[model samples]
Target: MPSSDDVYSQLKDCVSEITKIPRGEITLNDSLSGDYGYKDGPSRRSFAISLERCFKKHGMTIPKKLDRDKMEEAKKLKNVRDIVFTAFGV
Candidate 1:
């Protein structure tokens, strides 16, 4: 299994690709939109969907609850680290 840090790195890349925000500019203190430049709901949804796809690609089976959990965190994650924790439990 990939370590949380690995997962975090992949997530950073994924978020960068989805949001068109530079990975170096995205801080752990940054919210997905307020800090990372997500323009709207569809953009945010794209990020979440990419995350689910990445997790699946890495051989992680997302529990159905985690889908709802991700959506909840989608609104509430205070920072990038929260997204990492929400996804990978680190």
Candidate 2:
């Protein structure tokens, strides 16, 4: 498994590049729609596309059925560290 730090770094880099959100502005608590100005929510198709791109860039597989339910879980994530840890099944 990848280290938590590695995962966090990957997620931070992915989210920043995909969302076009500034590094300083990106935070775990920020909502995709409310905080990130993604009115459609973080689980929206567009966000998924960006996530898919990230996975592709890392030579990772795009998870299927990453819908609202999964997105909600993802949104509840507290930080890039959490996201990376969970994503790698750590």
Candidate 3:
């Protein structure tokens, strides 16, 4: 498992890279879709997939992509905390 610090740090970096919103501005409350525009399709999938590499780089293991085909299941992950909690279970 990735240390909590690694998860947050890497997640901040990823959000910054994906949303172009600078890491300093990123917050746990920011909605992955509403704030970052990761609504569906390639964007969300890419983010999920990228997390796999990010966590791996930190020597942690999480599913490569929690790509939920069902909209209802997918909708549950709305923010940084949601994504990290669901993906890392920590």
Tens digit of per-residue lDDT, candidate 2, span 13-73: 7778876877776666776666655554454456656766786689754334235444544
Candidate 3, 6-42: lDDT as tens digits = 7677777765665579888777666656776777766
For model 1, residues 22-81, the per-residue Cα lDDT tens digits are 888755666655665554666666656666776667566433223433444464234434
Better by TM-score, candidate 2 or 1? 2
| Candidate structures ordered by lDDT, highest first | 3, 1, 2
Which residue pairs does candidate 2 place in steric collision?
33-38
What candidate 1 gets wrong by more than 4 Å, as runs, is 36-46, 54-66, 75-90
* Full-model lDDT, candidate 1: 0.58
The CA lDDT at 77 in model 1 is 36
Candidate 3 regions with alpha-carbon error over 4 angstroms? 56-64, 67-80
TM-score of each: 0.58, 0.63, 0.59
Task: Score each candidate by Cα lDDT.
Answer: 0.58, 0.58, 0.61
Candidate achieving the largest TM-score: 2
Return the clash pairs for model 1, or none: none
TM-score preference between candidates 1 and 3, better one: 3
Per model, state how many residue pairs clash: 0, 1, 0
